[model samples]
Target: MVTVNIGTLHNVLDHVYGAFMHRTKISPLFFSGGWGGSKLELLERMIKQLFPEVVGQNCPPTLVKPVWNTVWETKTACLREGVFRTPCDEQLLSALPPECHNARVAFLTPKFVPPQRMACVVHLAGTGDHTFERRLRLGGPLLKENIATMVLESPFYGQRRPMMQFGSKLLCVSDLLLLGRATIEEARGLLHWLDSEEGFGKTGVCGLSMGGVHAAMVGSLHPTPVATLPFLSPHSAVVAFCEGILQHATAWEALREDLAAQKAAMTLEEVRERMRNVLSLTDVTRFPIPKNPDAVIFVAATDDGYIPKHSVMELQKAWPGSEVRWVTGGHVSSFLLHNGEFRRAIVDGLNRLEWKESPS
Candidate 1:
């Protein structure tokens, strides 16, 4: 009898699902609009400011008070839905499509909370996550553990999606960078509001897939200690667009055509290399380790079709003192099967941090 590797089998399943979902003939694919022209350069200049020495200083207030338009009480918690204008600088605001200018969030808090005993974790959006429902459900069980959950609607997703773009297929390569940058700014602001205004005892940021990458960036730039949890994320976008299952989903011909018309034509291989160069800007290792490195925890799959083991290990290696726990499944299966492990990581990471002493 031949032995079968369960993890490998799961990986195969993920690829099959991915191809059917993204690579099929009828679907209008992602990155179809190609590399954005002038819009991309502006974003690049802004993102370059994220080095270890100056990031904290550069980020300023990006949100006014969010108006909570909806509020209701659950049996054990309170829920609020609110909207706020994205606080990006003028250049970014000009570049962003009007539909994506405003941001939306859902907040859930436990009813019984003492001033210094509560913890809140902001959950960022992953690919195709158009609403707060999935994340809210993930954080629902954690409420018994006394942790509140906040979920943000990513730009170009949910109601914010551009009318011309298809579901989950971001129009251009630059659009991805724009989404990450905007999410970081908004998430940082929300965490600050929770701490300084709402007086939360401890705060953290967590996300899965693409949102996981953005969550890591936000946590790294935060001035104080925050539990930084990135679940099923790669070290860089390069791993996804250049080396993983997403390569098939990309619009290579469109990218080549755009480059050719703009400045110079490029071979398909050259276009791939260009994609690598652009996505390299998203490498998390390039950013500084979090203020509290020990508070970082990574949850990875044993066999992930979309993210390789090396991608997860690289970030852990770069940020020493960070912990990595492996769940026994591939990318898709792990996402569906491992909410418990993810919650455990969130609790464990938050526990590693010492609470701010009641502001002395």
Candidate 2:
């Protein structure tokens, strides 16, 4: 039997990741149609208007309905996911795709002592159908700790995914931007709801991969006092789609080819630039720093090909005084390799915050 060299295998995988990034293409449609200079400017303006303050005092509270899932019952806490219709301004809705207009936000909240403090972790799933496995794996530890864990279903995912689209594939870049906008807005609403509730303690937001990116944006935009923890996420959407593991996905390639053939007049670089601008709305650096920079924790993987090291560093630099914990493995493997340590860090971080804020 021949033995495989683990080091060599890792190097090969790294090389493949590099190739995927270089070979990936962007679509002109991402730049055109309601995403031009004026439209993009309008989008940015709208986001700024919605989150005028660091704390989302302007956003209206949304009514959340908790739906019990008996299948996920645990001794520590009652398992239930809350659903709410994401409220959006009429102008914002008109600008986004019709499918995203009526999108909803779903979150898994552990029932306990009214949660002295709640850590609303937005557990974003990768490019696929939303799975309970990911939710439990990422949010379970927090629930066990009695830290009311709430996982927000990213827009165009779970119940929000369009009926015609039988999977998590977003056919157009427009849809992805709409998803970003909806999730950001919905998260603001949730934060407001948490703050409005009597006796609800501090609320923190954390996310993994795509969800991490959303958490970063939400943390920066929401003015409320929240601990922001973004794990396995890049600073910019451009890096995520252009240089991340998502470049290898078949859906992206198909969309690229379709856009290439349809918009031959536009060059790849032009399309890329436009897409980057659209995604910049959610870019962590574009927004304000968190109210408490020290409360922001970033979990990064040294060997993560899905999120380039530079992107993670960008976010770190953007938020001075923020802490980072490095794991040793690629995107997927790092989750399993450092899950225990990551969970410990989260629990400890949030607990420390709670203690520090307690009356002396």
Name every residue pair that clashes in candidate 2. Answer: 54-222, 54-223, 55-223, 55-224
Maximum-TM-score candidate = 1
Candidate 1 residues lying further than 4 Å off, grouped into runs, are 53-57, 61-63, 358-360
TM-scores for the candidates: 0.97, 0.77
Q: How accurate locally is residue 120 in candidate 1, as Cα lDDT from 0 to 100?
A: 92
Q: State in Å the error of residue 31, model 2.
A: 11
> Global lDDT of each model?
0.89, 0.62
For residues 1-360, write the lDDT of model 2, one tens digit per residue: 999865445435755754553434532212222333344556666655534353345454453433334445565565555545556667667655555554433445566555444555445444443654565666676665656655566666666666655455565655666677777777766776666653446676777777778878777777655778788788877786666655544244344454566566555566556566656656677667877788888998777767878889999998898888887667766655677766765675565455323432
- Give me the displacement of residue 17 in model 1, in angstroms: 0.9
Could you give the C-alpha RMSD of every candidate to the true structure, in order shown? 1.7, 5.1
TM-score, cand. 1 vs. native: 0.97
What is the Å distance of residue 48 in model 2 from its true position? 5.9
Write model 1 residue lDDT over 65-120, tens digit each, in one string: 68895578967789999999997878888888899999999998888677468889
